[model samples]
Target: MIEIVDAVAWLVDLEVETVRTDAVQSFVKQETVFVEVTTNDGNKGIGYSYTIGTGGTSVLAMLREHLLPRLIGADAALVERVWFDLFASTRATTVGAITSLALAAVDTALWDLRCTRAGEPLWRLAGGFRPKVPLYDTEGGWLHLSTDELVAGARASQAAGWPGVKLKVGKPRLDEDVERLTAVRDAVGAGMDIMVDANQSMTQAEARRRAAAFEPLGLSWFEEPLPADDVAGHEALARGTAIPIAVGESMYSVAQFREYLARGAASIVQVDAARVGGITPWLKVAHTAEAFNVHVCPHFLMELHVSLVAAVPNGRYVEHIPQLRAITHGQMRIEDGHAVAPDTPGIGIDWDFDAIDDRRVA
Candidate 1:
């Protein structure tokens, strides 16, 4: 046991080169909440979760005032124990968004510490399921983009050898949504895979309407046309849509995914490592989905997802969003449409702490 440790947290405001918009929100900035823990034996590891722009400081306070006190001088190797300890402490409200989000911050940090001490990369520690993963680009739709900009973004994805791209839908008027998809489809031509995400911005009625309207255009899937929490609505939309129904990303917890699976309401699953309490639960969700014969096309952070997705039989696609490349030491690669995970152990990458943000003792 590398005797228990001390931890620290930092915040970085990562920039989005272009306005990335979807049904529910718009992003021009990404705030990465980074955590680093160091053992008495001089071993250190880094982990991070994104809060985008909300509740990050509140999370920082919770870890310092609550979670970190229990962690110090504890066994560094007891990653799972720590996960459960933190999770159990908050079980009453653990199923809620903030609780899960807080657990995720600790969960990711623990895994990073474990893998670094073991001298293995995160994917390998995560069970070395697959060293590379198939990827789909998420580009070509911002709320304010002109038709040409959207089309060009889609074209860029194809030109870069990406098989598919997700376009933003959920314009207030269904006709506007229809035109956007139509132009993007026509511009990208017949061969590319075009997926649409309403970003959980539409009402069930609106979602159902859009789904029916786009059935003729041959979309790969309709993602979160309604909010993730609306399981019953998702079921209804899933029934109405010609394309597969994809949801996750915003969703937290295995139980939520279990409900989604049991309802048979989702065909394309999007799990995020940082969102579902880190790798441990994320793996459970992937395996759970495997049992149902559903595809796990995990959300962003392709570098971290490749390992988990490879470990399962039903894993499908990794969303390729390159926002973190500037700060992460190892940038992800694409080879014939598959993303090759970095060769280093424990996520095999380093965050440029100085460049992204300054560090502090948590």
Candidate 2:
């Protein structure tokens, strides 16, 4: 048995490369919390989780004080058992962001160890349904971009052979949103898929109204139209509109995803590995969505999500929002229009520790 011998956690703040804006929030710096686990046999694995701007320190504290300690001397091979034990130990904080984020750090590290020891890439070890998934560019779709800019970005993505581009919605007036989407549709023609995200800034009534207005544009999906907890609202909205309701980026547990699926609220699941407590529950959410016949297009963490989307049969497009280029040694590879999963062993991310050490804030 490979016994866990040591664990360490730290914080790194990566500044956003561009001004990322949506209806509700602006892109702030990424507060990345990384955890490294070393086994008694001298093998090491690394995992990480992050917050948009806040709570990184809290996640780090949770790992340093509560989660990491529990990993010591535990069997590294039993990743799922370790996950459950940690969840049980942190029962009081179960199903919340801080605990979930903290748990993700440890859980992903264990997965890294498992994949490395097995001599398999994470995508193959996790599921191996495919080695590549289609990509959609979100970097040029910020809500702040003008219609001309949006059109230009969409045209650029089309020129690059990308299948889709996501645009941000939630303007003060519904006509403005329609006008922007109309221009992109007209510019990109009918071949390129167009998606829109409201970032959970709309009321059910507003969402319904916009969904009705945007339906004629032939959008791929409407993401985070309303807040995440409003299952009933989402259900009503889904029934009232032809556009697919995409959610799960804000959710923190598999139970939450199950609730959304059971109620038929969400059609596309955008489950974030970090937000859902790492690869363990992330897979559970994907399989759950699959059981419901829903497709998953995860939010952010393209570096990790590329492998995961490649791992599952029901996986769909991966949103392209590059935030890790400043700290990671390599970037996610895109071929033709799809993001390719890393063929390397472990989590597939080549961490540039020197850059991480330079960015360390806590």
Candidate 3:
């Protein structure tokens, strides 16, 4: 059995061209918490988790103070066991962002070690359902863009052969949101699939109203119209409208996803590996969605989610947002509207250590 000898954690800050806005909040910056674990046999694995603009230090603290110490004499291959130990050690923080994100980095690092030991890529090691998965564009759908800019962005994504485009809703007026979606629909035509996300900024009444207005437009799905915790509101909204309600990015555990699925509150499951406590629990959530005959189109981290989505049978779409371009040596392969899983051994990202070091803060 390989024992973890050393574990290190740090923070890296990444910048974007402009602040990315949605219906509820603005993206100030991306702070990624990186973890590297070395095994007794001299094998190493690197893993990371992300935050919008805050809490990276909290995640690092959790890793350094409590979680990393647990790895000292533990079997490196016991990913699930290690994950549970970390979860149990920090039970007070369970169901919260900091605990889940910290566990993600450790669990992911262990999985990376497992895949490396087996000499197999993560997608194949996970299950190998498909080599490639279809992708949809969300980078062009920020809430602050003008009507002209929105239409142009949608057109460009369509021209790039993306099968679908997601637009942000929840403008001050319902008509304004409808008008923007209508413009995009007209520009992209009826054949291209369109989705909308409100980012949990609306009330049940307002979400119902928006769903009614959006029903006739043939949107593929309505994402997070109401708050994520409002299971009753989502169920009511789902029953009232024909559009599929998508949720899960804000949820921190598989149990939360179970509540949404069992109640038929959300039709589309957007499970994020990082948010769900990494790939171990992520696989549980994905298979659970499969049992209910629902599709999984996970949120961000396209570089990693492409592999997870491609590994499961019910996997649907990968959101096209490359957040690691500046720190990774390679890019996700996209051809004919699908993102191909990387064949390299271990987790796909080849971290550029020098660049990451240049930006490291902790």
Return the TM-score for each candidate structure. Answer: 0.93, 0.99, 0.99
lDDT of 3 by residue, 1-362 (tens): 89899998899998764557998888877899988999999999888889989888989999999999988988998888888888989988889989999999988888888898899999999999999999999888899999898899899988999999999999999999999999999999998989999999999999999999998899999999988899999999999999999999999999999999999998999988888889999999999999999999999889899999999999999999888889889889999989999998998888889999999988
lDDT of 1 at 294: 91
Q: Give the per-residue lDDT digits (tens) of candidate 2, residues 1-362.
A: 89999999999999998999999988789999999999998999999999999999999999999989988999999998999999999999988999999999999999999999999999999999999999999988899999999999999999999999999999999999999999999999999999999999999999999999999999899999988999999999999988999998999999999999999999999999999999999999999999999999999999999999999999998989988998888799999999999999998999989999999999
- How big is the positional error of residue 92 in model 1, measured in Å on the Cα after superposition? 4.6
Model 1: per-residue Cα lDDT over 1-362, one tens digit each: 77666887666667775567765667756666676778898877677777665776767666666776777887868877878888887766777666666677667777777876678777677767777777787756667788888889888888888788887887778899899889989988879888888888888887887788999899988888887889999998788777899999888899999999999889989998878878889988888888999989988767677767766777778787777776767577788888877666576566766667543323
Weakest 10 consecutive residues, lDDT, candidate 3? 15-24
- Colliding residue pairs in candidate 3: none
lDDT values of the candidates?
0.78, 0.94, 0.92
Order the candidate numbers by lDDT, best to worst.
2, 3, 1
| lDDT for residue 34 in candidate 1, whole number 0-100 | 71
Error of 2 at 157 (Å): 0.5
Q: Output the number of the lDDT-best candidate.
A: 2
Better of 1 and 2 by lDDT: 2
